[model samples]
Target: MKRIGAFLLTGAFLLMNVAVMAQCSLCTKTAQQLGEGPAKGLNNGILMLALTPLVIIGFLAFRWWKSNKEA
Candidate 1:
């Protein structure tokens, strides 16, 4: 039991270290090369990519509710 607990703790610590140590590469590049037409495209793409999942999830949730209500 103690071995399993130690293994889990090690995994958690490694994951935390990786999360904190990594830099946002896209953000760094964007900061370096500010104010250009392609940057605007990148910003717009990120916004659309972020919103796409929300829109899809919302649609699926509404469909799920509607189908469950009729049953």
Candidate 2:
């Protein structure tokens, strides 16, 4: 039951999407002026930046879970 609850919670978190406007006015203006290539690069950079902390936290959580399971 605890495992099922945890799975549902994690699934809900993974599926939830929040619309966030992370760009400042200057950045938006620059991207608009730079054409498609630069705009794509900027977007990829933003995604990498955004995902880095989540990836780190997920890794740490996985490690903690493994350790707890062994005990």
Candidate 3:
């Protein structure tokens, strides 16, 4: 039951997509003026930044699970 609940919670979080408003008006304006290349780079950078913490958490969770399973 606990595993099922955790699976559902994780699935919900993964499926959720919230619209993120631009944080800096000046930066946004500059990116737009610079054209598609800079805009794409900015988007990729944001995604990489956002994924870093999730990746760390996931690795820690996997380690914890493995340790608990062994014991």
Query: How should the candidates be ordered by lDDT, best one leading?
Result: 2, 3, 1
Best first by TM-score, ranked:
2, 3, 1
TM-score of each: 0.49, 0.57, 0.54
User: In the order shown, what is each candidate's alpha-carbon RMSD?
Assistant: 10.8, 3.5, 3.5
Candidate 2 displacement at residue 17 in angstroms = 16
TM-score of 2: 0.57
Clash counts for all predictions: 0, 0, 0
Off by over 4 Å in 3: 1-30
**Location of the lowest summed lDDT over 10 successive residues in candidate 1:** 14-23
| Global local distance difference test of model 2 | 0.84
Leading candidate by lDDT? 2
lDDT for each residue of candidate 3 in 1-71, tens digit (9 for 90 to 100): 99899999999987988645443678678779989798767766777788899899999999998999999
1 against 2, candidate with superior TM-score: 2
Q: What's the TM for model 1?
A: 0.49
The sequence of per-residue lDDT tens digits that candidate 1 reaches over residues 1-71 is: 99799889969975773322122587648745875666656666666777789889989998998999999
Task: Indicate which candidate wins on TM-score.
Answer: 2
